[model samples]
Every structure is written in C-alpha cells, then in structure tokens.
Target chain A: MLVDPRATVADMLRARGISRRGFMKFCATTASLMALAPSMTPKVAEALQKARRTSVIWLPFQECTGCKESLTRAGGPTLENLIFDAISLDYSETLMAAAGHQAEEAMKNAIRENWGNYLLLVDGSLPVDVPEYSVIGGVSNLEMLKEVAAGAKAVVAIGTCSAFGGLPAARPNPTGARPISDVVKDKPLINVPGCPPMPIAITSVLVHYLTFGTLPELDHLNRPKSFFGQTIHDRCYRRPFYERGQFAESFDDEGAKAGWCLFKVGCKGPTTYNGCATYKWNLGASWPVESGHGCLGCSEPNFWDWQGFYNPLSTTQWGGYAQIGAAAAAGAAAGAVAALAARRKQRPVGQDVQEEGK
Target chain B: MPFEALDPRDAGRLEALTATASGAHGPDPEACESVRGRVDSGNVPLLLNEVRYALERLLDDGTTHAIDVRAIPLGPGEEDRLLDALGRGELRAEFDSLGRSEVQECAYPGVWCVTHYNEAGHVAGRFLEVTFTPALLASPPEDVRTGLERLAAELAP
Candidate 1:
C-alpha cells in the first residue's frame, strides 16, 4: 500500500537512543496498563517491535479541539506517545500545516492511498440536524465523517464528544449532535471517551492496535476495557475514606483539605470508569479528585445531562443498595474463590487412598 | 533396578529440591536466582490459567479487589517466582509504617505485593494483595482524623 512513510516503534525508540532496558520498561508499563500479565511483556515488546506502520486520520468535528490538544500536548512525551506519533498519520486537520482545499485534498489522497487499511480517529461529535453547525473545508461534519469512515480499517471515537455525544449533544442538543457510532455503524469502532480522555489510554489503544493488528477488547460502551475496566471510585486513593463514610462536605472543608473522598461534594468517581485514579494527569501529578474536586464523569455518555458537576452525588448516582450489594458479593466471591484455590493448592497430596487387596 | 545410584553432588541437588517442598530449609539462593533468569516457568499453563481467572475478576466490576496470599503458603522462592511470572509494574512504593513496607505492583493491573518488616528490620509479614488500588495508600480516614486531633491536642494547653 502507498501508505505514508513509516517506522516501527522499536526503530523510533532505537533512533532516539532508548536502550533495551528502557524499551523493555516501556513495554512492561504498556502491558500493565492494558492489564496483561507480566509474562505478556516480552510478547508486547516483540509485537510492538515487529508492528507495521498503521495509517491514521484524526478528524475533528463540532466540538472543541481539546481532545487533540490534550493528546498532542500530553504533559511530557513518553514511549507510549512516541509509538503513537510514530504511526503514519497522513492527515490531522489540527496538526497538518495544509489548510482549506489543500488539507482536504491531502486527506482524500491519503485515504485513496491507504484505502480500507488506515485508522479513522474522530475527535468531535457531528451535528446532524443543522448541517451548517460544523463545516470543514465546505463539507459538513456528518458528510465528512461518512466519507472517511467508509474507507477506514477501524473508526476510533477519540473523545466523549465523538464517542458519546458530549457537550455539543447536551440536553436540548441545539445542532442535533450525534455520536460517531450513531453515524458509522458498519466499521469497527473503539471509543476512547473522556473530557479530553487520558493520553495514556489514547496511546494504549493505538499501540494495542499497532501491536496486535486488532482493536483492544472493549466494554459495553465500546471503550477499551483495559482503561475503562475500573471505576475511579473503586481505585481512588481516597476510597478508604468513602468506605469509612468520610466525605468532603464542601470544597474547602477539612475533609476536602485533608483529601478525603469526594463522594459528597459532587464526586462521580464511584460511577465513572477510567484509569484516572491510577494514571493521573500531568504525569501523575494529580487528577480531579486528588485536587479535591469531584469527578465530573465527563467520559460517560450524556455526561452534560447528568446532575451538576459540583453538587453532591445523589444516592441513585452513587453505588446504592443494588450496586453496593453487587460489589460486596463480588468481594465475597473473590474471597471464597481465593480460599478454595489456596486450600486446593496447599493440600494436593492423596494420602487417604485405601487399597482393595492389601 | 529402576533407580540409578546418585552422585554426591546430585544428591545435594535432590535434597535442595526436596527442601524446597518442605520449606524447612529454603532453596539454594544461587539456584533461585538461576530460575529467575529463566524466561518462563516450566509450568506456564497452570500459572496462566490462574492469573487469567484473577484478571477476569478484576475486569468484571472495575472495583479494586485483593486476593490475600497470607493464607496461601508458598514454597521457598515461590513468591519470587510468582511475582516474576506476574511481572513488576510501574509503581513501586516504599514506606515505613509498621516497621517498613515495600509494596510493588504487578504488571497486570489490580495485583500488588506488600512486604512488611518488624522493628528489628526482619521481614515480618508478606502479603500479595490483588486490588485495583494499591494497598499501601488505603489508610482509614478515622485514623487520620484521630492522628490530626492528637497532634492538635499535643500543641494545645
């Protein structure tokens, strides 16, 4: 295929003077992020090394360019982003120097060149009712999406706006915005939804595809299960506080100042799913909850339609009776399974066998 | 005879293997390190199945869960072997809480190991806690409040 000139992530890392240990560490970290066993580290490293350059087209639509900005300006570039950037990204409306007709022409050319083999990354949501709500190079956002998605190997809805009809699709969606899934149904789509999403999650999805040549396992929402497998509340450092019923009543109260759980002060961590609790923003400096603010659940669908961000989470919004019972059951099940497995492992000898004809 | 006479050196190795099972005397340190150097456990299939099951549970609710290893007695060097199989992840935290604690995350998310030391600095308790959140950071809020209150009282008349 006449894809853009590309280099394997290994080659890029080597060229950048990353040693074998450094590269292995990066692979190990990636494996962990994807929740793969340590045994899979070498496999991940090898797969990444031999991965072919994938062509990606990042399409921005009727939303703020925050997704693009967050990923491109990820606090500090790591090996993950290095591999992501290493891909043959022939067209990115935000990143490309070409403008107007030239940019559109370049994308069409790239699409023609890589046809049916390139990745389609859409960052913004499309407005269906008002075609003029968003236009790129004279083509409406919805039309542009259909055209590009037709030839894509897989369509990745990059942010909440594109994946779940975010801010643009909030209550009374004026422009009548719709998510990419609502538009492109045939193509395999992966949602990396967040307000701006986690840079690592975005990179993980791309690397996962590059290494395995298939989309990473996704959740019901079509978000990568590795990143969305755990709710922020389940893993937050302040969860013990929540278990102990210690909640920050106000933004500046002692609980807040003491970094207690933000469940009371509009914290949606309990219900929101992402790796923010583990992989914080700004290179592990802090996440919203760590900063003493409640999670806004920006990555979830129709997040803007949810209760206000700063208001305390309603009992229904939090893990109420049913969810709590389920969580407890899961915990109990885990304990029982572990105990049974342990007992079986410990007492493996068959010493009580009786002989028939002694 | 089916059994061949063992060499004295071979006998030592056999004894070491048996000792490994008994846990009365640990495996040879050099032998343990040598096994660590091996890329994969000869018993990959079993470990793979076990770890996979644990991983499935982890992905179910996105809630952090722990599989306490205290009850699961391990043979000498088995802990290291398991951790090796699990793979050390990005986060490695060291702190002095009850004597000292070194907590390490496994390559797979939601798996962690914490080794606590006594006041004399000997290894006191070792736990392989599997959870979405690292166990070291899970201090109760009441403890924090009491500690804060005590500190305040200490400073007051």
Candidate 2:
C-alpha cells in the first residue's frame, strides 16, 4: 500500500521515538483490544498508514477543566505528542497558540475548510436554563456547539459532561444542562465518559478512527464498548477483600491500611465501570482506589444525584435490613415463649402458676 | 501395589498441605509473598486468582452449570454468537449442568463483568470486569473470552 506521506501511525510513532517494532506492537495491541482477529493487525496497520489526517476542534464548556487535565496526564507519550502529533488538532481553546480574534478566526477557518470532515470534541454540558451561566465570545456554549456540530463529520463527547450532562445535569440541574446527544442528532456521537475519562481512552479512540477510518463499536450508551463496557466492580483489585468480607469501614481505618475492600465504605466500584485499576492514572502509577479512596462512580449518568458518595452498598438496601429486623422480632417472640414454658415447668403443675400470674 | 510408600520429606509436605487446608496454618510467608509478586508482575495466575476470588465472594462456592464470555471491547457480532450458544442449549446447559460466576474488580472504573455456573461444577454466574483503557481490548477476539473463562475456572478455590 502507498502509505500516506503524512499522518501515518508509523510516522507519528517514529516522531515519538517509538521503534517500528513498537509501532506494530501498538497496532497489534489495539487490534486485540478491539477483539479483532490477529489477522486484523496488518489491516489496521495498513489503514493507519494510508489514513488521511483528521482535524479535531476541542471545545471546553462550563467545566472545571478536569477533563483536559486528565487528558494531559494520559498514559503513554508526552501530552503534546499524543494529541498534536497524531491528529491535526486545529484549535483547542485551552492549548491553541492563537488568541482573541486570531484564535476565533482560525476556528472559523477550520470549520469552513474542513466542513463535514472535522471532528468536534466537546468536554462539558450546554446550559439552556441560563445562557449567562456559560458564554464564549458573547455566545452561549449551546449556540457555538450547535453551530460547529452542524457541519461536523462526527462528534466525540469527551467526559461525563458532554456524554450525559455530567455533574452539571445532576438533580435539580440549575443550568438545565443537556448532553451532546440531545442537541446533535445529525451525526454519530461517541460518548467517552468519566469524571474525565482515562486519557489513553480518549487518545485510543482517535487512534482507532485513524486506523479503521471509523469509530470503534459502541455499547447502548454510545460509549465505546471496548472502554465503557464493564462495571468497575468487575475488575477491582480489592475484589478479594470484598470476597473475604474484609472491608474498610472508614477512611484511614485498619482495614483501609490493609487494602481491604471499600464496599462497606461507600465504594461505588461495583456498579461503576472504567479502567482505573488496570491502567492507573499519571502514566500508570496509581489510581484513587489504590491510594485507599473509594470509587465515586463519576462515569455513570446522574451519579452525583443518584449514587450517594458516602453511602455504602450494604446499607443502601434499607428494605433488606428491614427483613432482618423482622426476623429479630420473631426471634424475640420465640425467646419469650421459651422462657414462659421454662417458668411453667418450674411451677407446681400448670394450675397454680396461671392463678398466680393473673 | 498401587500405593507407593512415602518418603519422610513427602510425608512432611502432605502434612503441611493438610494443615494449610484446615486453616490451622496458612500458606507460608515466602509462598504468599511469591504469589503476591506474581500478581504484581501481571502473571496469568493473577487473572486466575482474581476470577476465583470474585466467584467465592459472589456465589459462596465455585460451582455452576454454564458460562458466558464477554470480551473486553465486545466485538460487533459477538453478542450473536453468545446468544446462539445460549439458545441452542449449549450455554444454558452448561449453566444447567455445571457453571460458576466470576468477577474482576480493577482499580480503574468500568472494567468489571460477572459469570454464572452450577453446583455440579458448571459455571452459572456472569463474568464481569471494567475496561477504562483500550489496552484490554488488545487481546485476540476468540481467545480473550475463552482465556478469561479458563482463568475464572482456575480461580475456583
């Protein structure tokens, strides 16, 4: 195949000092991760070699910029090499060199020139309730999102914000936050959710698209099945602790120091899903759970509103415990009956005992 | 004779194994440390331990009738394959006859799964795990789930 002179996975990898062997290994890893056959690696490798440069416009909305922070700290190569080196990231309001009118002009030009081919990566929610809550260049985020998304080839909703309205859209959503799916129905949308999804997850999606020229298969939630398919509980390292009923009751407790399960300490790991454990944060050094913190389940929809951060799963099923209380009451009744029988036996034949009781 | 006389050292090993099983004594510190080291090294045995530990916690026993496999980054047509296996009674029978479930809880979020099996050694529970990274999807499709299932089987105490 006549590999593209530019934008090939090899060229990108080489620029990062990754050897040809390492590049193939990466492709093989990607292919395997996608659940593709071993034979598919060559195809993926070829596709990536021939793939065209994909222009991406990353927009930060009303957010703490945590998503960007996580992306910057993503595992693998330097942050610049991962994003700027691979994809033609035309404009990132956070990182772009241009500023003021020049920045805005560059964005406008990218959208106009790229037209239906560019990818619009949105990292926050759109506040419809209050236009004044989040504004960029005198226009609401919703307005700019709709404008750019209209001509986009595809939309990547980065983080829980853009994916599921995130924390902003939690109960009593003050800004009436809405997900990207709600507004942009014209194109395919890939929801890469998390408080800020694993940075490698974000970059891998770009790699998959570059290699396959299409987004990876997604689950019902529009999340890439490869990443958001399973629950955090399923792959938790503390699972053994959970199994043995060894749990950390409180932060900094004995069990916590022993690395016991946090299920009793309001760990949402069971129901939540993400690759925090296997692929630790900050270049695979360590994640929150490894550091003795419980999972907050920031990826799931309305997590902040529904799943109580301080509430443990064992205590959450309040009704189940009610049954236990009932059982205890029955046991008490049985105990009372047994005591009465014992007293009657101790008394002179049944007659005198009843009379004395009366 | 079918039975061979045991050497004194062999007898000692048997006694040690028995004591460990009785919970009067646990695996020696060196042995425990070796296992921990293996796990940290990402050895295949780590996967087995994780799967088994999860099963023991969830099912109270590693007995089941059927097992269903869900690969990381579930493939596009993989569901159909599973459904077919389930419908034809192959999967259901495995659960009906002998199955067990296993779960893997990684530190990362969204990398969990469950499996099922039966009392007669069939897998009845689901195999669940989270995958926050794309690296998990880097396994060969056919082998991934099967390998997981095998590891889960080994995880049975």
- For each candidate, the DockQ is 0.01, 0.02
DockQ of 2: 0.02
> Candidate 1 residues A1-358, lDDT tens each?
2333566777776565554544555665567556565457669988988877888898889778888778877644344455665688879888889888888888989899999999999998889899897988788988888899899999999999888778887756799887888889899989998999988788878888888898999877788987887677655656545544555566545565455666666776756778886667754434666544578888776667666776655554334534433543564353333234322322111111112112
Spell out the clash pairs found in candidate 1: A230-B62, B64-B132
Please report the candidate that would top lDDT against the real structure.
Answer: 1
True contacts kept of 1: 0.00
Off by over 4 Å in 1: A1-7, A15-19, A316-358, B1-157
- Writing each residue's lDDT as its tens digit, candidate 1 over B16-115 gives 6557743635456654333222222123345446557766776886544443232222322444676688888998887653245678887877777765
- Estimated TM-score per prediction? 0.62, 0.60
Which portions of model 2 show Cα errors greater than 4 Å? A1-7, A11-19, A25-41, A314-358, B1-157
DockQ of 1: 0.01
lDDT of 2 at A305: 62
